[model samples]
Target: MAMEASEIESLIRTGIPDAHVEITDLAGDGNHYAARVVAESFRGLPRVQQQRRVYEALGGRMGGVLHALQLTTAVPE
Candidate 1:
């Protein structure tokens, strides 16, 4: 089954409590999604690491229940 946007957001928030997360359904099929995450905790992390953190938040759902996720990360200004 496809994941819900709220579930995605909740997972990220649970993992990164200080993060500001915005989720968009790219395909409207609940499979493809775009997520923009901003957090002070990401300040010194590399982009790949930042993305890893978000993926980790999803708890191994990336290639299973969640298929395509276009992710963007940024440090809070």
Candidate 2:
């Protein structure tokens, strides 16, 4: 099963209400995606932790239904 881009965005927003999330289907396939997430909550967090937050929002679909993701995270400017 492949995950939809909207689902990804929805999950991120659900997990981090204050986040600004952008999701792209890199391979034109729902299984592969790239997401850029910006949030005030990410401030002072390590890169790994920021990325972890996004991954957690996905509800453990990273290596199953979602397949692969190229993720970028940052604090709001």
Candidate 3:
């Protein structure tokens, strides 16, 4: 099963409500995706921790519906 970009965005939004998210289909197929997320929730966290939070938001969908995700996470300026 492939995961659509919107699905990924939805999961992210569920975790961080006020997030600015951008999703791209890296391989044209929905299997591979890249997401850039900006949110205030990341302010008190480290970069790796921020990314882990996003990964956790996927809720074990990473290897199933979503094959791979290239993620960039950050706090808003």
Best model per lDDT: 1
Q: Please list the Cα RMSD from the true structure of every candidate, rounded to 1 decimal place.
A: 0.5, 0.6, 0.8
Model 3 — which ten-residue stretch has the worst lDDT?
57-66
- TM-score of each candidate structure, all chains considered together: 0.98, 0.96, 0.94
Q: In candidate 1, list every pair of residues with a backbone clash.
A: none
TM-score of 1: 0.98
TM-score of model 3 (CA atoms): 0.94
Better of 1 and 3 by lDDT: 1
Q: Kindly list the per-residue Cα lDDT of model 2 for residues 1-77, writing each as its tens digit.
A: 88899999999999999999999999997888999999999999999999999889889988988899999999987
Model 2, CA-based lDDT: 0.93
Clashes of each: 0, 0, 0
- Candidate 1 clashes: the total is 0
lDDT of 3 by residue, 1-77 (tens): 78879989999999889889999999998888889999998999999999998988889898877899999998989
- Model 1, residue 2: distance off in Å is 1.0
Q: How far is candidate 2 from the true structure (C-alpha RMSD, Å)?
A: 0.6
Residue 30, model 1: Cα distance from true site in angstroms? 0.4
Q: What is the lDDT of residue 70 in candidate 3?
A: 91
Of models 1 and 2, which has the larger lDDT? 1
Candidate 1 per-residue lDDT over residues 1-77, each given as its tens digit: 99999999999999999999999999999999999999999999999999999999999999899999999999977
Show pairs that collide, candidate 2. Answer: none
